[model samples]
Target chain A: MSTIEKNVPGTRELADLVREQEEELAHLRARLAEWERTYDATPQRDALFSTSSGAEVRPLYTELDREGSDPGNDLSLPGEFPFTRGPYPTMYRTRLWTMRQFAGFATAEETNERYKYLLAHGQTGLSVAFDFPTLMGYDADHARSLGEVGVCGVAISSLDDMERLFVGIPLDQVSVSMTINGPAIILFCFYVAAAERQGISAEVLRGTVQNDILKEYQAQHAWVFPPEPALRCIIDMFEWCSENTPNYNPISISGYHIREAGSTAVQELAFTLRNGFEYVERGIARGLDVDSFAPRLSFFFDIHNDFFEEIAKLRAARRIWARRMRDVYGAKKPESWRLRTHAQTAGVSLTAQQAENNIVRVAYQAMAAALGGTQSLHTNSMDETLALPTEKAVRIALRTQQVLAFESGVTNTIDPLAGSYYVESLTDLLEREALDMFDEIDALGGVVPAIEQGWFQGEIAASAMRQQREIESGGRVVVGVNHFMEGSEKIEIDRLKIDESVERLQVARMAELRASRDSARVDQTLAALRHASSGAQNLVPAILDCARASCTLYEIRHAMEEVFGSYKEPVFF
Target chain B: MSESIRKIRVLVAKPGLDGHDRGAKVIAAAFRDAGFEVIYTGLHQTPEMIVSAAVQEDVDVVAMSVLSGAHLTLFPRVKALLDDAGADHVLLTGGGIISEDDMAALDEQGIGKLFGPGTPTTAAIDYIREWFSTHEAV
Candidate 1:
């Protein structure tokens, strides 16, 4: 306190006193040091040690932490051999990743309006979430589709709805990502037909359809056809897109749903990459070259609340996929060997009680996404723990991304947190763990067998149970929920409710679709689709034919059900 | 011994088009772990199909977890159909995205439990257990 006691007029007097104390302080310090040699002794065991996966704490990290494992050689340059840093040399410095948010709602017109709004609001790309019927290969107003029209997302039945969905939007410029899996090819065809009506060619079209069906069986459970045919449809799209839609990504093999389905990060990485590997294997088996399709194959992952762990996950994912594609698959082209992925912040982790706290959770999750260097990012609206996000909520969510992108100053450096002992070690550890899981998956002959045998589901279920048990027992703290529950916080949210009239209106549209379309062509398409189901022909062409003939998803699913029979899941213990 | 020999079948169906099934799936797992033979009708089950399945399976409880707010229309029809089928013993219940005032009004119509977002999995298991244990005598 006395160090600055003098006024400015007397500042020289204070400096003189400091000079006076300087000699006295040195003498006192010497005496204190001599006394400390005899008196001051404290045990030092305070250093915290832990693994990169956030498991097991210890007192220190050492050569033993490496434990006969080499830190391993990382390749130089971003787009070179094993792209541990990123998929491109000048990432985001030259151009930022496309900001793609999933958007769809009650009606085609509604979703179109939303899409135009998002594009106007600094969003660089669009991702569509079709309603259940559209996803399950059903059209609205089919008997099976009653009461469920436009419930989860927009209902796209035939070309008419597709045209309306993209009326003012240009297909040639705007890249659209569809979240449909089962009837992916047909849905893409519906988009194609709509685009053609607007005079846009396939070559000019852009974006991806998350057309990965294997992951659907393993995680999302929105599959329509059996596995082999589903794979055939996917491979056909890979062939088609590789040859035609050069600007479009054919499939986004998904691990986001797998993680959301209650898997650990390691399981998410291994299972998703393995699924991607299987697709590439299938594509190669179809006599297609690896370089042709692998460049367009993309991955999707979940960015959960674990910050460093999620970052390590992305880094490890790229390294693991790069190594496997180059050393194992012998992919000659550098693009074929890199792993480019899109990330969505964890939806399963958001809470509704103290929904405001979810904004904090999403901030950290979005930070993790950026740190992971995602090719695309979709930040979930804080209010999405309930229904589809309202426009106000969606704008806030998008703004959160913009704030992180511009103001955070995180983009000033590449991999800014790269060399922290914790981060680097965690990166190595995550890769090893995921690599071990891949070995385990390979021992079972890959993802399809693992899915069919319920191995994937079983692993996710067990992890989910453990996490739930932790939460229920108060071991985990979801603040303002179980632990800090305020019981009755006056929550008044303007919940976005779908009008009952939406269903009525949708049913009328479907009725007109049925009456106006050629009934003869519709019946013939359904019958031919049935025959294709019995035979071994790739179902994509036939499904596209049916879509072109204006047959609905429910009609085809009904006809296919009669032939392929429904799946009866074995009781997973 | 006053016969205590019935397993309370709780059919947990995920109604409508919400594919966010982690809660539904976790609840199904919890119910199963609690020794209630829970029949999960997968995702995207319609109201009519869910009610029909419960009746066909002769379940004691019909618990549908819908994060989508279609419960206003979906749950009432299930209760009405159960009444029509003379299966009043089958307690109709639902949870997810429901408010207290809405839950109270629905509870007045004999809906069993209106579990919402933070309602613990253990609490659900316990409610089902206690309710079934008490009502088996009737």
Candidate 2:
């Protein structure tokens, strides 16, 4: 009861007061309608402004919008079940999120210097970006790697390069995240061998290998083996890592590449969570307990331009994942119910024109990631839309995250925008939309079959087409490109150029490593790997043996491909 | 339709492991909207697979994309394969994260024009249409 009701001392007087307020509201509504009729609204291009995911944004929200949703029951405290507030009770209060910048270019040695530089300048962790050759499982000397080695990212052919990548930085001290998918297992083995050489055991090592082959088929298109054996390889990693490296995440189910492939936020959430569920089911099908592997599973998301929508997507993702893991999968542990994520600003949102504007774009996206309670973040450099970022550009990107951590008052409270009418409505809307998509995927017989049928690709392509059409039709105003008509912007900043000599140096290094390593031992280990691939035994240990014997990445990959066969994506209109 | 307005058949191929297909798919849709029959060879195509698909499909143009920085090697290899298979009349064009010098060198080596990242999809569509119009009798 309000103070007025207490003072009235009767139910009749309170009802009379409510009647008077209703009359006043009715008069106010009439006056507002009359004023709106007389007011000349400004001309707009469209009748309704909607989000990228097609949710219409209303001009005003009120108590009516929040009437049905119960905040006390749903919006639980941080670190509690259904972690909408956060994965931890004291999120950034205890410690700020890890500023793990993704950096690599040219060769391993050059990338090593960048890693050290980033580490010295407040970067909390490392994220390796492998070149096209390494990502596709090819040696630097392979014909397929010609003119490509050490161009887009660092090229690591053998364990020698992986060793050089973390020369001075101890692997046990800093967590590393590698962004290779198709040859992810081979790269993981190289990392393990490198750490072992550093006298760090596998049990103490911590990091994530983006061993997400499903997304490779869905969007990234960087897989070596077919889906059946590829999934088997992933399950094998899950089983092995559960026993060997307790702190390491065997797979970071990724939706960053999916969003970059032009998916909407809802699609990114639905498809990514579906992929994670498929991984869990695969582990269970392989006779592993759900709690054994689900807790170690992590997520990587792309925080895009829509600030509140991105935050709500993250929040909805956590709630849905928590409910699904507990109710459907019967997970008992709280850790299994939590969704720990690492987010990166959308590279697709960066613009080449007026490249400096990207700095502001990245800062906003980073803030959204923090507000969404990400455990780690990567801010894209301003010049990333053009090429691999130069040192200065990367530093600015890292500094963007740093400024948000230090200056932004967002960290003062967890889920600061949790109670807003707009946010709660959007979060529930996103959850319902994502659940509908999950039903559609389930009707399609699951994620793998859907991938084979090209459903995900078609959906992403259609979304991308709609966005492109909107931009071309002037319905969407991307600042530097469509709006703000000015003279042709000349690029004043220095761009990073990869000299041809970097390729030469890398090829020379490959030759030297080849000449020094024992060819017989490499052959023997590769033969064993090929033999093991034909049987039911796990290939991780065999691949690790090859890594120890100095077999290059392509060698182990080729051994498996000879048995499992290479994947060819189906065409879709 | 008039006999002079023959339907142009174009083959869009991704001949490398680079999964950046937003540009490739956009161009495919643009060509379809521009009234061309587009056969998109999906990802991870070698030079031989792409050339064989071009010859088998008898495409008028083979527009490939490789953002893996292997354009210098992949483009020349595709051009040579097309020449060897006697499908040399098929115009070969592509684009990626390539430098101006490399693009010029590839163009000089008989590959068609190379486009950078932000080039409009219509630009690619017009290039294929114009090349076929001029080389119709070849």
lDDT values for all models: 0.79, 0.88
Among all windows of 10 consecutive residues in model 1 chain A, the one with the lowest summed lDDT is A45-54
lDDT by residue for model 1 (A1-573), tens: 222335554688778988876677677667766665654474655332332233754333433334343333453456655677778877767777678889998999999999999999999999998887788777787665665678778998887888899988989989999999977877888887788889988889989989998888887878777787678778988988887789888899899998888888878888888888899899889988998999999889999977888998898888888888888787888889889889999998888877878788888899888887788899998878666788888888788888888889776567666655566667787888887888898888787787778888888877877778767877666777757888526565556767878788888998988889999998998899889878866665677687778876677667666777664444443
User: For all candidates, what are the clash counts?
Assistant: 5, 0
Clashing pairs in 2: none
TM-score (all chains, Cα) for each model: 0.87, 0.92
- Candidate 2 deviant stretches above 4 angstroms: A1-48, B1-3, B80-89, B99-110, B136-138
- Model 2, range A32-137, lDDT digits (tens) per residue? 6666566447454554277779899876554456755766556787888789888998998998999999988988889999999999998999999999889999
Interface RMSD of 2: 1.9
Query: What docking tier does model 1 reach?
Result: acceptable
Name the lDDT value of residue A209 in candidate 2.
93
